[model samples]
Target: MATDELAGVQSVESVQSETTTKRYPVAPGVQLNVRSGPGTGYPVVKVLPTGVSVPINCQCPGTTVAGPYGTSNIWDNIANGQYVSDAYVRTGSDGYVAVRCG
Candidate 1:
């Protein structure tokens, strides 16, 4: 391939890598709820299947919850308008694992 074409391919690969978010495992055997907002007070939008992993787009403070990991107020934004309590996700940290949501 020509040098320019190679450079273009490399640039595309770099962008793709940066956009690929890491998926975190949910607590074992739990059908976790996906809330509309960051807190439990928000309505449930969906329920994650047991043993499913989720990619956290961002995190924000929310209602405190206790899960297998521990109690926390951090909520993970898996998708637009979809959130799950960070306490249920094994992000290997008791704090925020991604950028804070706006």
Candidate 2:
């Protein structure tokens, strides 16, 4: 995919609050690993498949977007807009519902 394509994906807004606007990534083949805790050092969370776009609720306590293998991000939901977990988030723009992919 082109770099510009990923730009459309939701970017994290520095100032976040109950009324703050939020965004999430949605890309195909976006690999994600839901960690037991904030950082690494636990079992993975189902190895999410491609097109599986997680929501970004809020930013993690101490996490960055720079990494070698997978992408780490904090997300929430579109309906509730609640920040939940810190999982491996990919830069995409689609796929909220689960669909069989090869």
Candidate 3:
């Protein structure tokens, strides 16, 4: 029982750590696009100039595309409601680097 409880706690901690906001820079000259939602289908909300460092709030799976980080579908939440493809940022993780957005 103790082991099971400890395992549960560890799982929660992992999830919490994944959700922790992380700072990342826009790939140089990418002029990354911000979307209202997590996909290209979503309207382009804004554009961030190159070298802008943003706080990644979370991430969710979105449209896949080849980018500075190679091909990926993960979209990162950079602001309150703004999202940009994780593929365009240099997170160094080709896989999901943050907890999926709810």
Candidate 4:
């Protein structure tokens, strides 16, 4: 997908909270591992399947990986404070695509 295709998924200022929830899909054939924290050192809490569009609440610093969105240390919070690297997420921006998860 084109880079701009992921742009404007949602505007950060549109929300009134410190963090916002937005939907993003798991890359095809990719089963994204959800972690308890922002890095590999954290426990794997869940595994997301391909074709699933989940609501990412926010993001936090983590290990960088070359994924569909290129390299980044950001991790997306899908639910229950679980994280998955933003590198694997096609979040449009090459950097922090969501508000930082505190």
lDDT of 4 by residue, 1-102 (tens): 556655544444445344445677777788989899888899998898887877778888788777876777888888786888887777777767667777
Tens digit of per-residue lDDT, candidate 3, span 4-42: 999999999999987676788878888988999889999
Rank the candidate models, highest lDDT first: 1, 3, 4, 2
The residue-by-residue lDDT of candidate 2 on 1-102, one tens digit each, is 677666544333323344454444534455665544444444444454556555454344324343432444433232332222333344342222221111
Regions of candidate 3 where Cα sits further than 4 Å from its true position: 1-20
Q: Alpha-carbon error at 46 in model 1, in Å?
A: 0.5
- Which candidate, 1 or 2, has the higher TM-score? 1
The candidate with the higher lDDT, 1 or 4, is 1
**What is the RMSD, in Å, between candidate 3 and the native fold over all Cα?**
6.7
Candidate 1 wrongly placed segments (more than 4 Å):
1-11, 14-19
lDDT score, candidate 3, position 31? 90
Stretch of 10 with least lDDT, candidate 4? 9-18
Clashes (backbone N, CA, C under 3 Å), per candidate, total 0, 10, 0, 0
Supply the TM-score for candidate 4.
0.74
Clashing pairs in 4: none
Per-model TM-score, in order, reads 0.86, 0.37, 0.76, 0.74
Cα RMSDs of all predictions?
2.7, 15.4, 6.7, 11.0
